[model samples]
Target chain A: DVKVTQSSRYLVKRTGEKVFLECVQDMDHENMFWYRQDPGLGLRLIYFSYDVKMKEKGDIPEGYSVSREKKERFSLILESASTNQTSMYLCASSDRGPQETQYFGPGTRLLVL
Target chain B: QQQVKQSPQSLIVQKGGISIINCAYENTAFDYFPWYQQFPGKGPALLIAIRPDVSEKKEGRFTISFNKSAKQFSLHIMDSQPGDSATYFCAASYYGQNFVFGPGTRLSVLP
Candidate 1:
């Protein structure tokens, strides 16, 4: 079984603060993704990394960035957290191809006050 | 480009009843359709998936019905139980690409 771990399950930050959400996968999957889930909006992709040091912007990447310094770890960074950034953030990792099934972490519920 | 529209923002079903959620896609290029189930404060997990080549696929109590011509697909949960209550999402993706998820339908299985 794939084990995806998030650094924090719950977090609260003040406005304009820099926030980091970390994700680690034990399966050494080559593809990792960051998504923010909000009520009524479902899951929207924020960023994705295909390989180490490789990153791509998803549909809603504004105010969000990603880092993939290693294969097992992917981190999402909020340059300046705002109240609107409060939401559940999910991290998922999949093997080589995009068609492969993704294993998701429990998710981090971030509250930007 | 890639958009998936889902209906029934919320649904309620009695135990042992049938639960259905539908979704339609505008991008004909998408070949993979998948359904995900999410519990509160948790990430969505893949429940079942189907390819355009197949019209239907079943796993346990979960089934996926696909219609290529209509560009639509649906998820059916048979013998629904209270434990089945969750948010379900339908998604479509082309081969080896990012999936576009629907708005999602929250289902409540009352016992």
Candidate 2:
């Protein structure tokens, strides 16, 4: 079984503070992704990394960035957290293949106050 | 614009009844479709998936019905149970690319 783990299950930060969400996968998957899920909005991609040091912007990449220094770890960084940035952050990893099944972490519920 | 459209934002079904959720995609390049189930406070988990080549795929009580020409697909839950209640999201992707998820449907199975 693929295991994806996040650094935090819940976090609260003040406005204009820097925040970091970390994700690690044990499956040695080549593809990792960050997504923010909101009510009625579903899961919107924030950023994705195909390989080490390789990053791609998804549909909603504003106010956020990513780092993939290693294959097992992917981190999401908020330059300066704002109240609007509060959301449930999910990290997923998938193997490189024709039919990839993304395994997601439990998610970090961030609250930017 | 939403690439994938899902209908019935919410659904309530009684136990032993069937629960159906539908999704349609506009992208012709999409060949893989998957359904995810998300419980409260938990991340979405892959439930079942189907490809365009197959019209239907069943895993236990969960079934995926696909319509290639119409660019549509659906998930059918037989013998709905209270444990089946969750948010179901339909997604589309080209091969193994980044998946575009639907708006999602909140299902409630009344016991």
Candidate 3:
């Protein structure tokens, strides 16, 4: 079975603070993605990395950045957290194939106050 | 722009009844379609998937019906149970592009 683990299941941060969400996958997939899940809006991609040091902006990339220094780890960074940034963040990894299934981590519920 | 559109934002089905969710995509390049189920406080999990070449694929009580010409696909849950209640998302992607997910459907299976 494929395992995708997130650094935190829940997090609390103050406004204007920096926040980091980490994810690790054991499947050695080549594609890693960061998304924020919101009610009614569904899952919107924030950023994705196809390979180490290669990143692409998804539909909702503002106020967020990503790091992929290694194949197994991907990190999401928030420069200045705000109340509006509070959301459930999800990380996923997929193999390098057209139809490969993307396995997702449990997710981190972030609360900014 | 929402590339994929899903209908019935919420659904309630009784046990032993059928639960159906529909999704439509605008991109013809999209060849792979997958459905994901997300429980409360949990991440979305891949439930079943279908390709354009096949009209339907079934796994247990979960079935995916595909219509290539209409650019649409749907998920049918037979004998709905309380455990089947979750948020279902339909995603579309091409060979090399990232997936575009639909708005999602919240299903509640009444026991």
Candidate 4:
């Protein structure tokens, strides 16, 4: 089974604070992605990593960055957390093949105060 | 602009009835289409998927009907049950690329 685990299920941070959301996958998939889910907005991609030290910006990459120093771990960093950044963060990983069946983590509900 | 457009933001169906959600894509380049079901407090999971080559694909009571010429596809849930109530999202992606998800439809099956 492909297991994707998030570092935190819930988090609260003050404005202008630095926040990090971690995700790890056991399947050693080559692709890892970070997405923010909002009501009526669906899942918008923030960043994605195809391989170690390889990152790509998705549609909504502003105010967010990603790190993939290790094969199993992918981290999302917020330079300065703001109230608008509060959202449910989802981590997903998939193989770099034609069958891109992304397995997702439980998600981290962050509240930026 | 939304690349994928899903209709009926919310739906209500009685048990044993049919629940249908529709999605249309603006980018004809997309080839892989997948539907994801998400329960409250849980991450979305892949439910069913269909390629443009097939007109229809079915698994159990869930079915995906696709129309390549129109660039539209739909999900049909037969014998809707309370447990089937969840948010359904339709997504389209280029082969091996990032998927663009629809706004999603919240379905409620009345028991």
Best by DockQ: 2
DockQ of each: 0.55, 0.63, 0.61, 0.57
Tens-digit lDDT string for candidate 4 (A1-113): 88999999999999999999999999989989999998877898999988999999998999999999999999999999999999999999888766466778999999999
Residue-wise C-alpha lDDT for candidate 2, range B1-111, written one tens digit per residue = 339999889999999999999999988877689899999999999999988899999999999999999989999999999999999999887646567888999999999
Q: What TM-score do all the candidates reach, one by one?
A: 0.94, 0.96, 0.96, 0.94
Instruction: Give the per-residue lDDT digits (tens) of candidate 3, residues A83-112.
Output: 999999999988876676677899999999
Q: Which whole-number lDDT from 0 to 100 does residue B56 have in model 3?
A: 99
Worst window of 10 by summed lDDT in candidate 3 chain A? A94-103
Candidate 4 chain B has its poorest 10 consecutive residues by lDDT at B92-101
Candidate 4, residues B1-111: lDDT per residue as tens digits?
348999889999999999999999988777688999999978998899988889999999999999999999999999999999999999887655567888999999999
Cα shift from native, residue B59, model 4 (Å): 1.4
> What DockQ would candidate 2 receive versus the native complex?
0.63
The list of candidate 1 runs beyond 4 A from truth reads none
TM-score of chain B of each: 0.97, 0.96, 0.96, 0.97
Q: DockQ (C-alpha) of model 3?
A: 0.61
Tell me how far the alpha carbon of residue B61 in candidate 1 is from the true structure, in angstroms, after superposition.
0.7
Model 4 per-residue lDDT at B19: 96
TM-score of chain A of 3: 0.98
Clash pairs detected, candidate 3: none
